[model samples]
Target: MPPALNRTRLAWAGDLPTSRAACGMGFVSTPELGHEAVAFGVNALARLAHRGGLDADGKSGDGAGLLIQVPHRLLGGQYAVAALFEWDPRARAIVEAAVTDGGMRLADWREVPLDHDSLGARARETMPGIWHGLIEDPGVDPDEWERRLYLVRRRAEKQADQEGVRMYLPSLSSRTLVYKGLMAGTRLADFYLDLRDQACESRLAVFHQRYSTNTMPDWRLAQPFRMLAHNGEINTITGNRAWMRAREAELEPELRGAVWPEGSDSASLDNALELLVQRGWEVSEALMSLVPDAWEGRGDLAGPVRDFFRYQSIRFEPWDGPAALAFSDGVVVGAALDRNGLRPLRWQRTRQGLVAAASEAGVVTMEPADVVERGRLGPGQMLLVDTRDGSVLRDAEAKERAASRHDYALLADRVLVPVERHHVDLEPLEDLPAHHALHGWGFEDVKFVVDVMAETSAEPVYSMGDDIPIAALGRTPRRIYGYLRQRFAQVTNPAIDPLREKAVMSLRVLLGARHGTLEPEGGTDRELLRRHHPAVPTEYKLLELESPILGAAELARVLEDAVVLDATYLPDESLRDALHRLCREADEVSGVIALSDRRSGPFRLPIPMALAVGAVHSHLLATGRRMAADVVAIAGDAVDVHDVACLITIGASAVHPYLAFATVGDEAAPRYRKAVEAGLLKVMAKMGISCVSSYRGGEVLEALGLGAEVMEMCFSAVPSRIGGVNLDDIERMA
Candidate 1:
């Protein structure tokens, strides 16, 4: 008989302790056949729970560490621990014996002292709001309050507590959790919190304290319902913050009493849109407008699909990154990623329909299929595994997986249908009074028709600014980051359906739009109409024919004719020239356009280009990072992004990557990483550096900040763990 799989739950090295989060963040699937599936599920949980790597953004004064759930093999020992740390490699090994076994006494917890002396003493003497209880109780001893100076004492204690929190910091460190009294190991890396429940023991600050990907966690501000985890860098968070801030600056004429507190951008944005939906609009309507899709109009889609596309066309794009989001109202729980589909989100199904996502799949071992599924979403897609719904549902209507191999053999023969621009012929429109057209149309008529139409609206078109879909980003920097952040939640690291389809779809979409030929195969064909790599004309003459059309429709047509095929391939000297032309336009057309790549290597065939790509690829391999961030950061207005692919092969160092499709290809590119890492190490070796030895040898613990991670990695005999609710455990209990 085949080996039976245990119920899916999170697991790690025996030493790592499990952190009891207040809510759920990544994908949560129901456990099916045990072993293979269970292994994957737990890995996802572990990865999601694992702390993130340091922020290379140079923002953190001290480099960051991700103690979440890394494998434990790094700590060499008999029956080795499972935790490991990807650290700065500059710190000293932690003094293992320094950790005491008294279970961190109350004296060690260091509750902040609230002093009522000085300012408070004087203020309470004059003002009523200064001291609520003490003032109410006039007989209370003012001497005690005056000596302690309540607020001051609290601040001091808070500072002291901060040090303790930092000491248990994220790293290659591990912790042990008493889960059902089992010695399951978990590293600091796999310690993500699920904020869907009422605040739990370690989750009192979910709403106020955002986790420090690099910065510090402010428990005082965090509250229940806010999610905190790690993935790639998010450049768009700033933009979203800007948009939310600008929107709040104005009263909107409708909301007169609204006053959003500063630094509450993320929370406010969530609240504002939620309010809109609760007030009337559907979920799609509210989200789409906030996170619009790339504009490539499709005339063939049914109402819902068209509506979804249209919804994308109108809203302001959200910033991009590979983000693994955690959200809740202290009730509903969920997570989502950017549309580029970089990063990975995973989950295990349980009795209750909840989903968890993270950067690694093994974090949750019970459910580990990497292929795409309903609970597993593609780019530009949202997985809605609501605890309330008891089933996983796709929120935005995503294109179903294609049925047949792309007909690339006849790629040049498809047709294009662009949406006609919104312009009325003056002569004909003049004859009809615009105001009079509304003649007897009552508000009820519009509402009634819309409601009825909504139910029967063949396609799934949501309203604008309704839900902040991860589809809002436009550039490579944004795309890479968006995918990382979004899919990190998919820790089981499922495949992105669309990325696999990019090449096939690219040829098909281009052939149809550029050639102006129509060939409908199935329901999803309409999706091509919405956005295909722009239609390309074989020659200048064909380009002229489609030149008259404007807006996304016309643009889509032109894209087929002119869009860059291998966006990341180009010669060094010619690189600047090609990028200049690509970023420019033929008069009215903007250089901003769709790009496609096979994640291939024209660069490998070319020496200079190959060298560049080798460097970049090498860096990604050694560091387990991505190339888009560096490339996008360096790309100017007229820059050619193709060179970025070269960087992947050439430069070596760690960076968070956000790649998908063929772009999303495999778990990662190994050879490229080897080249990048070897090259980087060679350079570092020149400085006489190696891991923990050599003339350049440094202290391992303090220098590298690997204490927590070390504990985890060493935890097989002493595994760290996060003790919290997992979907399977909850299911079994239920």
Candidate 2:
């Protein structure tokens, strides 16, 4: 009997190496080189055997995989359809159903020839039941049929997931093929006989060796996904995945119910890229949109280029993290680095028209004289090869072409809502009367939070060995931000040093509704979202309240453009209901909603700023009104640097910490802002994020005591396991 479908293996199921490391290599030639390229790839894999992970049993490897353009010549010419399948009866039925549903007939079927016994007993034991089949659909365009197959595959996979069957397609394309598994590099070539075939040749080949830190390496999780292979971790994956699911309501029918596979962040990223490519986005555009550079504030970029990124930023969040990725569509092949430049990718071009890139230099050996050029990928850089043209495109040339594809400057300038025009003086908070200031800032807050800010102009740090109670174990109730510890980059990918790389960091943020796609019919209101800027010039429309402990003048300014919903004296149920109504009403008003706590004093506390901002932000997102409005946090409770960062991370577009600034005095306001900016930059860099905008609303938070239901609704996708406090519990604490 074939191995049971459920008994799949993963690399991290075994012991992990003390020091994390990973390696990947690829080779592409102009003409088909058959077994020669395969042989070289295999030999290179063998050379990197140390990089392959060990499973629990220690003998079996975690995973290894290779990708190549499909070799049609080996099949003896044109065929109607060709596909691989598991030998299970259920698998067969599912494929048949998919083909019929797609209105394509299976004219014939053929198994890929292989010697089962030739692979050792262990290899056979690890294998899934496998077969290759063919189909025929007369008069159907090949590309269209491929698309139909993609839909069919998704349908089958979804059905299998529902029915408890293991079904996957290593390669299901006429242009490219993928072969990967949970096997060591040394055994991969020996276990899969196809790698030895001289006829299996192609112009481009890329590969990935997994070193997953958080997830166990599973058979289906092996790399060199359909169109790309990713190295390094995506630190922003939680938020990235959440945003993808949130937009599902707007996705096409074929893409509906399509789920990301259960794998590492890299796998999920590949899933996103594949989805976009299938929807007809150019490979370069899709990648650039997902992994954009720090283009917003950089005076170095041409107006068109900056406009291109700014527009795309409105449509998608950066798949921000430490990434070195290689992508292809059989015609164009390329690789990119994360803006942090934490992951290493070195490339070399040969005189013979081959371009090779890997995690490390010298993965593929060649004579120095044969090398035409060699260089390392800089931060947020890309190296692309257009196989059809047989030419390489550097980052500037590639982005320039993408930018020129549309009138991005005109679109951005016309649609972006202007925030720079709203800039305000800091005079409101500075001239506050002593009694009002005293009411806003408590004595304890002044001594600890405010004095610390005055001394360092940054968030205070605890000594390394300082002991604190874990949220799960603490007897006392904890703040939502306190329960959610900040996660940082480690091991397989290093974090960036913000001070050393200040040029690439950005605090620029866009607030408002999406402008819609580049299509001509897109909504004008949607385009209004990208206009808000963090800089002082565009600061007014974003409205900075003097404080949540608002002065009379500040209250007057906010009331002009926004409706202030008082949470100051309301009970839990009434406040929750009022906040809900206010958020919905927020969109119809000007796009700003300021949550204030002016009535609260040392004796009476307001709702926790974290809870208020989170609840409001979550509601806006749930109602599809999040992009239509911006949440401005005005609170006396935000008396420290951490409080401000927490507010922004939880979805505040702009934070007005009236108490902290007031206590520090007017002369120190600019210093306070710089310190807050620097502190937030430090936080982002520690997580391998180069842009504050990428870090904003990213939800890289892990709540310890929050109930699953409350977290699901409010902090969606955050790691809130080991439940503790519910909304009632939080209300009592407040």
Candidate 3:
């Protein structure tokens, strides 16, 4: 028979952990110290218990977990102790089978002795199944064997899961051990017996007390996710997940196809980082690659630093959003923040070599004279401690080492190709035609829209709030982007102020297909520090498209040096097919335009601009040819700021609403451009993104009624919780 089921029930009827910012705290002392630090860690959790969420029952917490260095005596057998209680014969057989299957030999299974009779009702009710297993390994290299042991644990857990057995791995590494549960932070120590034992000690302990936005709590979804604890959200997680899927061809079958735990964005990030580390990347380098600072347009940073980020950006888009994280690999402990400093992380150092960090100050108390330093983690900064070397590296020192590891500037200059642009000097737009009747719309309605723009040029404001049904449910056909709405920071995390914090924000973007050869399928490259080689030459023109609101003359001038695929005359070819062919055929396909020349009731482009761009971008990525060109939307249907922002959000680098230019005339183009820019800024500012590039291809949207299949194709991983219109509806609408 299968192993007995022992999973925590999914029952949550209370406030979520994400309703407010989470409180994550860590305590680490030098020299592998014991109990004193472990006690401090538990005390820290108890002090911050109020930050955790409470359910309707006011007994269960949102979730809490603690990670600490593995006790050497436990694995070294110096203090070996026999089993206090005999393991069941059936359980032993299952554990042995799992261990053998994972390429490890099992020595013995021991049940952790617990006095359930003495436990409080709440602790007894909320506890999960627990056990301690020993592996047969001769005294050998610890790091190598421990890594293998970790993988073995993972594989064994996967096997157990398939047999309907729920294995709760609080900790599986020789270097680290985890103790966690679905209990209030204040009760974590009481529920996990190890925490209560004074003899159990460690030099480092990281704790996380979660408060998710939605109150539906699952015990398995708790923080301190195996490797790290993250606060704040990953807004670009949809696109980030898509990129990970695209790289599946280069991963092992189990890793490529394994089911991810249903946690928050932080869980996904930890999974990715684990994979990268298993592929030979240093933890610090992996963190930098995943969440780099604003470097593209900054001249203040060293050339090597800028080059490092520029090269990494092509391979991985920034996990852009507000975030603060504390991570550890048993020997190395660290913390980092996102580029936008929307989350708080404060740290204090004691003279006796203890460093404590948390979301709030005073979580760990120390005497005034004992305090060596007190500071907070800034945007894109990191703090790392290496217990092996007994050294601590702050942001600058850590980044400097990462940057200087390779000649990124030389690599970038040799293989990085930028967009090409032609300089056009032109007078302000003037003497335009009265094309108000072009689409058969009344001139007065057109005038009213244009007049409102003229009046609101200084500060565009909207009086009519959006309350209509989404396109999937509406009677009138709408653009594809209309089906998805931009999701912004809510109660859990704070949003950035574009005007107040422009220094850290960037608008620069890089467009074109990647140039490097594909990494080998189902394999990892062990050369983590080698210079990157591009399959194609990296040197190309850097084309910066500010906005799509372009005049005909300006558009013509820019196209002189570009290979333009005119949407106006695709002949018998589908736009998607044409764009794909262009990407494959051209040596340097820099730009694409979706043009609408029809001036009748079918005023919209045959293909909705958003759908066209999204389809093209998704196809290019699928075919391993996304860096070929930038998509431009020269649409007639886009006039208001909403239309333009929608097009850009979907995938277009820039959008030219030429119809608006024609209707408003040349003299009004500048005013119209200002109004549109202001409006787009307001829209983006709502989500706290400062620049267009960060927002570009973010897939930071939620679909109210879009079907799953279409969303998977054009906007995969986008949150479309409420399924609605299918492909049939989309085709009919189009």
Reference-based TM-score, model 3? 0.78
User: Can you give the lDDT of residue 601 in candidate 1?
Assistant: 40
- TM-score per candidate: 0.31, 0.83, 0.78
Top candidate by lDDT: 2
The per-model lDDT (C-alpha) reads: 0.26, 0.64, 0.61
* Deviation of model 3 at 495, angstroms: 2.8
Over the full model, what C-alpha lDDT does candidate 3 score relative to the true structure?
Answer: 0.61
Q: What is the lDDT of candidate 1?
A: 0.26
For TM-score, the strongest prediction is 2
lDDT digits (tens) for residues 280-385 of candidate 2: 6678888888899778546877788898887676667788877789888766788888776777888888787767777777766667898899998887888888
Q: What ranking emerges by TM-score with the best candidate at the front?
A: 2, 3, 1
